[model samples]
Target chain A: MGGPGNAKIEVVLVDDDALVTRTLSFLFAGEDAFSVQLFNDPVAALRHLEQHPAHVVVADYLMPGMDGLQFLSKVRELHPESSRIVLTGYADKDAAIRAINEVGLYHFLEKPWRNEELLLVLRRAGERALLLAELARRTEDMAAFREKLFRALL
Target chain B: MTDAPGIPDPCRALFSAHADPAAVLDPARTIREQNAAARASFGEAAGRPCWAVHFGRETPCPPCRAGEVLQEGNALRWMMERADPAGPAAPPGVWEVTLVPVRDAAGRVTHLVELLRDVTLTLGLERHLIELARGLDLEIARRTAEAEQLAGRARELQAAIEQLREEQADLLRTERMAALGRIVAGVAHEIHTPLGAILSSLELVRARLAAGRTDGLNELIDLLQEASERIRKVVQTLRAFSRLDAAPVERVDLREGIESSLALLAHEMHPRVAVERAYGPLPKVRCRPDEVNQVFLNILRNGVQAIRGQGTITVRSFAEGGVAVIEIENTGPEIPEEDRERIFEAGFTTKPRGEGTGWGLAICRRIVREHGGEIEARSAPGRGATFRITLPIEGPL
Candidate 1:
């Protein structure tokens, strides 16, 4: 995606099937408002997040080696501010319930998903990520202000 | 008195020798002579008065034909029913009496002959015949009453059959309308998905055209064709599923009915409900497949309506007790205890006014019962509701 502003929203999408992510990437690529990264391997996506964390992480639930639930659980621990969404062909109620309660999933969209539904969920996640980032920045500013006030008292 | 005749003594002897129960009486009503038969019947009256010997009366009997004949100088005959002193068990008998006047050659009444004849057996047979005729009258009356009762029962059975036919016709109409409503909703939802994709692709095409770009036109046309094809198939499938034909009753797999119904409901149900199947091996059911599938659709709709939000629906089919049983369980609101009894009754609805006419379950029950099958709802007040339908594999009972 091309954008003149360097402060655009960053989104990372991971799925075992490369075709799904490739087709889905075009939906975000058409917009100048987002910088979307696609990966077929969850480990590679996880490594990238360690160095440079994204605001929203998308995953498939029925992946090999590491499922969407486990991967999102790790994402929750690594970057609490990022919003997690699972997109998969398998639609199991128990699995959906577990994902919501244990992994703190934001949305569960079944495959053959419509473009509007995906856009609606990703837009909501982006708003939440922006709110959390602003809150974290204010906390850092408050901590630095407190350190300065202690030095002045000394 | 035996020799008081103006004629000879030989006439008196001939009168006494008569074999009939006869006796000779003088004008003063005294017995002159009696034949042997008369002595045997009246206890050997030789010189006693006629009344004293035959009737054992102190006075002359009233309506005496003997005195009348003596006055008229003619013979007389009389009939009467009287009890016989001879046989106690014998019924009352009729007696024919004759009073004959004996005259001399000088036109003078000499004697009166009283003939005694026993006619008890003839009277007994006549009485028996009358009694038999009365009995025959009563038997005819009883048979007529039985025939009337049978005719009344036949009329009632005919009325009951007519009522069942009317109810069946009403159920068919209501189910078809309900099915149409559901299929319409599904069609709307299914067509919306592809329409959304087509609209989004058109937006891309418009943007590319403004940028003077034609590289992705082929892919865009392909997407449009694919989406339009989806719309066509959805319409075609709905047409096939809803085609109305003559009722073709046959043996078919029970699972096929369930699957077809689920496919019709997939567009509406997949997003809202998670359906679980635990189907066991079941025998082919003898039924009209289209009607049975309609029942399946109604039951699924019932479960969906009960659930508030997201719910689980479990469907199971198996053979039990020479019947094919299909059970559908819903994680929705439980039906109350009082409602279960009248749930299948016509026009009985638990849903609010416009949302439900209360015909779905009733129609389902009717269809099942007409196929020699039964449908029942089992649920605790809050544990959720399950509908079980059992159908015979042979035919309608």
Candidate 2:
């Protein structure tokens, strides 16, 4: 789990094609605020996410064993605070949009996407995930403090 | 018989001289006089009743014209059928009877002259003509029915040919649409992957430039050049594939066309399928270059789809005996015995519905035949399938 500014944003990128995943990882290499993990298979990515939680999970929409949406939906169950993003081709734009609305996904990035837009969107998603994690920690802290006060009163 | 009469000698002479059987009847319907012929025919009946002597009846026969002739004071004629007097065992004989009334000077009918002629021979001829006409009518009816049946069969054959034509057109359209879909999908992946690499590498270079770092600049440019070359090759091959308005026939290196097809379909066959090529020295063959490329593409795509997890596709080309021969073999499952021959037929497919149009090989066979070439498939149970195509060195004259 990542917190506010200056904390490293853990990013997990999943795609069946190695060329796609490799270039995406290179895109985030220069930014010190982001750390990216790459997986060529969606099933393997899901298995990795079980133990190593990510702040932002980026997935390609088309894969052989499991599609990006099914993988990301399972990611949501594993880590509700992790912001999800999907990569799609121009031909599947309509299906990707529907997936965004149906799965409550954060956003969809089209293939051959501009580097600047991709970086900006991932940056924002990471910040949002960090804020949600912070909020959840504060809520837990508040509950624990209330329980202590009630016990002291008893 | 001529001299014996109850009348004048002139009338008796005339009646006796007549060739036909003639009899004179009194007002009481009895025979009053008989000529020599009547005496011979009726056995000398002079006082017997006229009806009993002529018709062998107990009384006057029905449809008698005697009363009508007497009242009208004229002659009457009618047709009748009776036993043949010449041969009693023969069929009935027809007769025409004539009754003439004899009157006195006061204009009152007093007697009737009955004449009988042997007309059975003329009636027999008339009956034979009527029977021939009836037989002609039956023959005409049979011929008309036969003509109708032939026309019906011709119509059914025509309809069957029309349906086959429609099915052929439908298969052609479906095949064209399927080819277009495949081109769109494969082209998108081939171009988009390299373009993404080039752009992303450019972004990394810009970031390094902004940071004033000069290291690894050559590697970045190398990546850019490599990606650009790939795009350039894809475009060039695509241009070759789109030569729709070019010359219909050209002397082409068949190997180049095969390479172009393999380049366009590289994205679909990579990583899972290995391609091995063995090209022998060959002369240029005259063919439609674009159409030949399409054939290679379709066959290669089929080879790729046949293999499940991983397999190898082998392509070999050589020239022999004034012909160019190309063989493509894949290490996939063997084609069934029943489907080997029918695979080239239109609308025959093993792929599940919606995945194949079943006209790939059908189109291939047609295009080859158009160029005066031959295409065939061979396979055994354990061995894989191989498609062999041969084209004449010089196209159809």
Please give the DockQ score of every candidate, comma-separated: 0.03, 0.28
Q: What local lDDT does model 2 show for residue B236?
A: 86
Which residue pairs clash within candidate 1? none
> What is the lDDT for A77 in model 2?
93
- Per-model clash counts, in order, read 0, 0
lDDT of 1: 0.75
lDDT of 2 by residue, B195-240 (tens): 8778888988898899998766677777778878877887888877
- Which regions in candidate 2 have their CA more than 4 angstroms from the true location? A2-22, A30-34, A39-110, A116-154, B1-47, B71-77, B81-139, B142-146, B149-153, B198-223
Q: Write the per-residue lDDT of candidate 1 for residues B1-397, one digit (tens) a residue.
A: 5365532577666666766577778888888777777776776667789776665567776757776788789999886555434322223456667888888887778778777666667667878888888888888888889888999998999999899888767776866676666556556546654554566666667777899988677777677677778778777656545434424877788787787677766644655678999999998877888778888888987887687767888999999888999999999988887888698987789887655777777788878989988999989866789999999988673
TM-score for each of the candidates:
0.51, 0.73
Model 2: how far is B3 from its true place, Å?
7.6
